[model samples]
Target: MPQCAIITCNNTHRRTKGGNVRYHRFPGDHNTRTRWLQVCGKTVPNCSTARVCSRHFSKECYERDVQHELLGLPSRCRLKKGAVPDTNLPLDFLKEEVLPGSAIDILLAVGLVPSQPVQKVSGGLPRE
Candidate 1:
């Protein structure tokens, strides 16, 4: 049985009488893999042997066709590009940690910066 890669998730792709659960491998592309790692707050070595289960993805991540729905075909098993695991995470996962001198801190170091108000012109666009 393959277990989910997410540290907070415990869904295992085990065989069952009704059907077997599905797991997806981490993307091979550097950018995509980086995004996955960043979202999971995990490193490469930790995720090298890990796989995320389909339950982690949103319904949009899987493909569904009208015909398939009519015929009662199984939902598509493959994950779409840019699909991020969004389920079975710990509550703490929703809380982002702000480290000292982090980007947000740097941006707020000088206190709140005021935004320039948009000026409307006759052309229906803001003047530069």
Candidate 2:
């Protein structure tokens, strides 16, 4: 199942109290994608596979009549074009910004940075 990208949301393609939910793919448009990231408090490096569940959006975002037509089908919940999440979201979703020269410090504090710099491999793509 495609999991909802929101860290705190447990919505998937399952039926919930609200009804059958949908998982919308992250926008191909960068600006819209950024807005989605901000709403969910995510810093996803690449969102090609990211999806936001229907629960995160308000009623205005969906075409209820169209979606209602397909209520019993495996596929339900049709959204409007260029739709973006605008409800039930965190206003402050992102962690503190990583300041210049402090990323390593923060990573180290969280034990993510290596003890030493990793050696660069010389066998990948050719340099330009």
Candidate 3:
């Protein structure tokens, strides 16, 4: 029941309906592991337990050989070397709820927009 290491991703090898999902471990090589960390934006010191499901990768990441097809192999496939996860952004970033307030109010609550009144110049342009 290996699950994706990404906090936002919910894909798991065990929950896949038809065993189509594949899980991959972090590379053993130092350089490759570093690259994986950079691509995945993870900072865990030990990646031995970290697993990434195939949904994080593009279709081109998997191997599709004639032998695999002939053998009637499960859809669980191995990823190509040097492959990076290039799938869509995780579900967490897609939330789109609108708060009941003016745009400035929301900005002020988040400390994004300044509260001070900006003085306008003679030409109606903001003074630097």
Candidate 4:
């Protein structure tokens, strides 16, 4: 997934010049980056266009993936020792890549980790 330099506010009515929003020519029906097309053999209305599958994907899935990635970033210990983090890898790849007790659920399941701290809406360390 591509990380954006700007973070958008949660309120849609409030507009700003930042967020992960982007524009690319996507297939009209798809909402994800999957390599498969919606129609098995039938081509898209426009010939010679390949697109990520959007039909099966929902906004919730996207959000879940995003949350998983965000949570995973701080959980991975290998990145804490001043090494370059592997957070750049694809979310699917990260899910499949095996490292012992590295997954969030697994870490919690074996009682090897504590719950993540709750996020506050405001008033913490001043932004640098």
TM-scores of the candidates in the order shown: 0.56, 0.54, 0.58, 0.18
Q: After the best TM-score superposition of candidate 4, give how far the Cα of residue 109 lies from its true spot, in angstroms.
A: 11
Q: Which ranking of candidates, highest TM-score first?
A: 3, 1, 2, 4
- Residues 1-128, candidate 4: write the lDDT tens digits: 22221121122312323533331233233333222222222334542342222222334323234454767752211111111112233344336555566588687776788656766557865444
Which 10 residues in a row give candidate 4 its minimum summed lDDT?
76-85
The lDDT of each candidate is: 0.70, 0.71, 0.73, 0.33
How many clashes does each candidate structure show, in the order listed?
0, 1, 0, 2
Which is superior by lDDT, 2 or 4? Answer: 2
Candidate 1 residue-wise lDDT at 42: 54
Q: For model 1, give the 10-residue run with minimal summed lDDT.
A: 12-21
Over 4 Å off in model 4, which ranges? 1-21, 27-93, 98-128
lDDT of 2 by residue, 1-128 (tens): 56688867877665454566678888878787777787777566668887888888888887666455567644446677777877666645543564456777778777796565456559854444
Error of 3 at 1 (Å): 3.7
Candidate 4, residue 32: lDDT:
30
Native-referenced Cα lDDT, model 3: 0.73
Candidate achieving the largest lDDT = 3
Worst 10 residues of 2 by lDDT: 91-100
Give the least accurate 10-residue stretch of model 3, judged by summed lDDT.
Answer: 88-97
- For model 1, residues 1-128, the per-residue Cα lDDT tens digits are 66766766666655422455677888877788776776564554755676877767878776656676789986557777767777666555656775578665766786866577899999999998
The per-prediction CA RMSD against the true structure, in angstroms, equals 15.0, 12.9, 10.8, 20.9
Q: Candidate 2: lDDT of 111?
A: 77
